[model samples]
Target: MSETAPTPAPAPKRRSTFLRDLVIIVVAALLASFLVKAYLVRSFWIPSGSMENTLMINDRVLVNELVPKVAPLRRGDVIVFRDPGGWLGPGMGDDLVKRVIGLPGDTVACCDARGRLSVNGHAVDEPYVVLSRGSDRVVRDDFSVTVPAGALWVMGDNRYDSADSRVHGTVPEADVVGRAFVITWPAGRWSVLSRYGDEWDGVPAP
Candidate 1:
């Protein structure tokens, strides 16, 4: 009788080294992103209509947290800051965003001879001002005040609906959080926020 050939031994099972490496890579990436957000930049979401026509409700903004450490805030810069007058109310949190209209030691007023806002005796043409709801009306209120030293005068674009400097007075410089640089969400609306304008350029320094 012929002897049967011995069956070959089954091959040893292999380890899933690829999957293990992939998991490690993903974890590292997430950690790096968190560090950057906490120290360099942060994402903020708009919760009200205060900055309408410029930043709408639910809009996503990118703030450069490192900016305050590197440079001083300038006129016309949109900034996120802590509430100064307790206007946000208790348990309502503290952060709010508004446009910088007057710097320390500068005089700011509303409703010039042409119904425009003025800064440091110069009339400012604000094309971005949002009109009141259901009417072709602009905020024509008369107000005049000098921004105190180490403070800022800010306001919202939607003047009729916003409760800002007009109601709370000036904000201390230390209250400013950071400068808004970009709108990143709602893919179709992505754009860098610009701080330059004819009026902004002509604003006199304190």
Candidate 2:
């Protein structure tokens, strides 16, 4: 009888190895992402009209959480901070984003002679303001107050609708979370949120 051809050796078992490698890759990616989010940047969503016109409801923003940890916050920086006075209400959560108008030991006021806002004796022209219905007829008014030491004066772009420093007074620097760097959602609206340098150019440093 003809000798039967030797059967081919069984193929090496590779499925297990491939699965293990894949799992390792996935785990590594997750760890890397978590570290980045914790120390470099993070995402936040707008929940109310407190910062309207500049930041709309449901807007997704990217925050540089690591910046404040490395450097001190400055005037005119738009920041996200933990809510004080329990303004957000019980169980409503913390964190409110607003523009920095005044820093520690600085004066913050609203409605300059030209219906603009002012900081440290310098008038700030805000083109981002969105006036509320019927309120537009009554031109913006003026008020003056100094920011207490270790605190900040913040406000929403939509002054008529926002409940900010005008309502709650100054916020402490320790409460600040991070500066908003970008609006990352709604693809078509993606853009960097840069500070209005001119507004703060002449204002004295605190």
Candidate 3:
């Protein structure tokens, strides 16, 4: 009667090997991250002040690689592209980052009466452009051009210092690597890269 409780089934053996499980999980996570970086997103660091307040030197950013392929490029998008040709001088990198100012077929001009850049007769309010020492105009020089098919006009937020479309010429869309959507470094400076949507509201289709 005190027949003994069938030796409590040896406490069910733990099926999970702790160390092995952990290692497997870690490996999987790293592989997934690698895949994403390779095809979907990638990281880049700013090397100059061309993007200033929006993207400071050494600031890290996450770029969406599908842009212009899966996702359409917009006028205010911050993009990274390879030097089309002669865009970089000796000692400089082959890549550059700039904001999209004109799309293919767009008529882009500088300095309306208010010194704001114009696209298709609409004056763009660029709150992002930084004035250089003693400079009041966002764009100091006057120029006008129509973006060619399969090309994009780009410029830096630090207009005075950047040698962008104004200096080198329109970048072929094929050369664009990606669009920068966020700033990810210098924890204290973390922020989403803004497109300043309203600024392009008045711009007409190219």
Overlapping backbone residue pairs in candidate 1 total 0
- Model 2 clash pairs are none
Q: If both were scored by lDDT, which would come out higher, candidate 1 or candidate 2?
A: 1
Per-candidate Cα lDDT values, in order, are 0.83, 0.79, 0.89
Better of 1 and 3 by lDDT: 3
Each prediction's RMSD over C-alphas, in Å, is 5.2, 3.9, 2.6
TM-score, cand. 1: 0.80
TM-score, structure 3 vs. true? 0.87
lDDT accuracy of residue 119 in candidate 2: 74
Q: Tens digit of lDDT per residue, candidate 2, span 94-168? A: 888998888888877666555666677777766677875755311255678888887888888877777888778
TM-scores, in order shown?
0.80, 0.81, 0.87
Residue-wise lDDT of candidate 3 within 1-206, one digit each (tens)?
57766675533344356667888999999999999989899888899998987899999999999997799999999999988889878978878899999999999998777788899988888988998677667888899999999999999999988888988889999999999998889898899999898998679996
Question: Over 4 Å off in model 3, which ranges?
Answer: 1-24, 132-135
TM-score: the better of candidates 1 and 2: 2
The sequence of per-residue lDDT tens digits that candidate 1 reaches over residues 52-74 is 88898888999887766678888
Return the clash pairs for model 1, or none.
none
